[model samples]
Target: MSASNAQQYAETQIQQALVDGLLAEGFFDKVETEWFSAQEAESLIGQLPEYHQLVSDSAQRLWRWHYDAKAGLALVMLLRPGVTQAWEKVPGSRVLQQRQQGQALAWEALTPQRLIRAVYQGMNALTDTLDADELTAGQQVFLDALAVSEWQTASSVDHRVDTQRLLERSPAEFFAIMEQWASLLDRPYHPTAKAKEGMDEQEYRAYMAEFAQPVGLRWVAIPRERMLCGAGVAEGDQGPVAWVADEGLRQRLDAQLRERGLADSHVAIPVHPWQHQHALPKWLAEDFEAGHCVTLEVSDERWLPTSSLRSMAPVDGSAHYLKLPMAIYSLGASRYLPAVKMLNGDLSARLLHQARAKDTRLVEGLHLCDEGKWWAYMPPEATLFDEAPRHLSAMVRSYPQALLDDPSYRLIPMAALGTPLPEGGHHFFDDWLAQRGEAITAQTVSTLFGELCECFFDINLRMFRLGMLAEVHGQNAVLVWKDGRCDGLLLRDHDSLRIAVSRLEQHGMQDPCYRIKKGHSNTLYHDDLEALLFWMQTLAIQVNLSAIIDTLAGHYEIDAASLWQVMAQAIDTQIEAIPFEDEDRAMLREKLLNAPGWPYKLLIAPIIERAGGPGSMPFGKGETTNPFRQAGCAASHDRKIDTEENVAKESEALERKSLEREAQESVA
Candidate 1:
């Protein structure tokens, strides 16, 4: 791609994020948009190349909104409007602003940085609490994201490796490559999705999963009495050593401990290299001065980062993947490892196991990573929710050994499937098409995607029936493919499990006593089933599958409506097959298929609202037009029309046959 193309693409993503967010968060309602018909904007459409294709139809409209009342207006074309409005190509890509006092407005191309600043200034007018510092910080983040995204897009063109070679290698290698591709596309539809705030360009290339660079662990020694160790963290630093298979590295780490003359009393905790260099010194200065924390220089073990940057897999192939704390902001939340979160993961895992045992479908279709082995530093006075303690913690997420060892089974993160290669094809779907002996047509791809939807929704709905829901978004949910079929789901990062206490009791299970910091809002337990299903509608369907649809439509030139129809059918099938109470089943049907809109997760507004406060994750909710309803209702209406036409044709044929018989009898 040319530099101009790369920059334009990055700016487009930022523009889409801003308009979609503004719409969902109801900013437009505060200051409504002014629209023009295609005929009215004929001259404007002829002048701009971007608007040429969008205004071909008479129904298309051009939208103008005065984000800044003093001088300017943002311009975009409206494609489709529902719960979430879909605009043509790049909304806000071009702005018509006044250049001089009482002068005619001229169109000016807007960069991502300027777009964010204009929107921020516009929003600041409506509210008194909007901070200048926060706006500056947000602008910097947007610029960082734009640069990183441009580099990623340029790199993706030549980054293709042989898919067969990856699959033929060890599971570790195959997963690493898949994750690298997945990392290329971050969370869908977010403004600053690619921003790694703390790292510079060099650190980003070195540390991000897309680069596939081997990362070395930094070991920190904390006295045993001061550390809070989980179940599998063995005594005398053996747990940390066990992650390293090499004997030489193990010996070096042990020697480093002994050389400090505190080997017997201290336990080792692996720290991210970036954290060790920047955050550790600042967060643990007192501990180092008091000799409570020791930083060792013996770094030998090498690992590869997965899509989730904090999680790392051993370079030498193992079931174990390490999760550590890195003090950086991504998606408006600090990526730190807190013990309270880990403990909740343990609790959620137990609940998952119990729910699986009760339902045979879950037993067949759901898999979980072993998040049992974890350790954190807890001083005598600090609580589980303390910020400082979270900076020094680790969790070992291990796959089932049997699943990993089996040659027929493959683990691919759903993000990999959702993110298409920049060179115009998807690696996973191409392989699937070849394996199935089918041609790459829209029908074939839709068929395969339908199967995936069936398996994915089956497991998710089963958990929903049992009053539990996993964060089945692309990153957390891994599709388990066995012998060319999407067989089951493998879930990791089990920290934020949503559940309904009443539903659990109906299935003969009790609540797993979860710990929450005092006075903090509790989002884990929901009183009503709709609250739990909100997660299903947003994360699983909207965020995860919608991204896949976008990629597939763009790559295969298939209509997105067709894919949404397939998904709606799959969801309908599952809701009926799963035996729910009559009332519950009706509710599911109404909310999922018949409802006018589904709950939309507001990503950007919530982050902006936070200004700069610490939290688990930033989220706000709004409603979006139900994609399922849009497709399903259209499909159903089409089928109805077809049936009526067939009946009319049959009646005409019968009438003609009767008339012919009557004429023959009269001649006789």
Candidate 2:
């Protein structure tokens, strides 16, 4: 057979296997059949590229994410250039779909290719709104970067003898490998940063955590006045205004900024070396020339890119993490920082920190890594739609150093934990277990797994009850692991957090933002805050914790159903224990634990619908039946059965005792 035909046959086998697997796991929203026309299948086969068994499946070995067919179809058009033209080639193709039990099912093929499109389309859709008719050179560069990044990720996940060397790597190194694995699997999807010009591709991969990239950030300093700054303060500490770099880079930056009259201005912003070189020039050619943005390449600090593409941390084991807006489009939007958000970045986070601080458990267990410091240039009459100003922003985030109170406590992102080691011997969980010398058996692992679920549920519950709702999806949610145990959730990205004004009013908590912005464009919102928060947790659980549970269960032969049950119970337990309650909080509690149905963000579809820009809310929400509520029912049923069994046993024992007493009396 031709290679293409062989590829087609293999692809069908994989899809069928996945369909059967999902069926076996009963992981579907419901057991339903979808009928598809021969035409639709053909169209879909054309649209979705292949998911290879070796590399792509290797990532799925980490977690099986949700599949939305409509989102998939939409994403296919969005990812490649000439969306309309591509469809035109297949003119007869309908808005193709399948019918499951006579009900229409949107067809989403969860191929690595589709995953790539979901991310690229989601992100590029936001940027591509301004461009049309084939890819520009820069846009092509962005796309090329994504493909290469995808290749790096795909190659890395192909765990085999070749990756045996990777086992010798450190936690950071291994986790960074996971970071690359996740980069392609992003919510909006972005490939790893393309290899820098003149840099070896192999070397570039080494610099990225996914590629297990070992590299330092090149820092630059821009004048404060030259950049639009945001750090939430009613006043006081300025936060971090300077762009971050290594010690040597910092020394040089100080001298350069001072020499250039920038330090004198108290207006220097740190920049990522890649952004300064690759993205910045193309994005802000006129602005840089006009001196609206001025930078001094200071020192080179070794920083590792975390799972979140734009966020970077010190590779040299520094405590502070820098969150800079790169000009790259990853996920749904450009990873760039906008002026408005920068102005309010700190406040959004500070609001959550301060409010949650009132609750001791939350304060200790839930770390808010908000730096509140941001600096960026704002050109005169610059609107958000304009790319230059917003992309040139940087913010600093405080590492959850507090979570490190126990020397053995390590702050690992949920993504890192889910990532499989290239070599067969260990993974993130194995590493944690190794530290404590815990035996890896079903009973021990299951017990600890239950604790992990409980930790996640409670941490989210405490924060939500505190009236601080943020988008704590997989990337934002950090696992505070102590020895081999899961400690709590340490979250980053404060500006993404939303506060319920009504709930805050009840608690006498001040609103985080002075101005209210509608939609998810900013943190401040008056209405739907509770609903958004609720959905955010759902997204976090499904994407992060649930994904972890599924992976662990599948990989280790643990009962997937049992793990999910534990997660469900954890959710129920937290809702029952709301410390202080009010109407809004009560409603939130009801919806979380007992509501008939819950809403989940249909993130990719919205990006396609909006063509990637902020359409309605950049966070797309969809309704799903409340699994927690269902889990509650299941738990109740189990309890009732146990109660009945206990009653029967007692009755049987009492009857025997009475007979024995009667026999003894007769003998007397």
Q: How many backbone clashes does every candidate have?
A: 1, 40
Instruction: Residues 319-371, candidate 1: write the lDDT tens digits.
Output: 87789999987877789998899988888988999989988988988998988
Model 2 agreement with the true structure over 170-266: per-residue lDDT tens digits: 5444434545545433432112322222224454454444544545555444444455555432233332533344556556666876787766554
Candidate 1 achieves a global lDDT of 0.74
Q: All candidates' lDDT scores?
A: 0.74, 0.51
State residue 379's C-alpha deviation in candidate 1, in Å: 0.7
Q: Which run of 10 residues does model 1 get worst, by summed lDDT? A: 638-647
Q: Which candidate leads the pack in TM-score?
A: 1
**Worst 10-residue stretch by lDDT in candidate 2?**
80-89
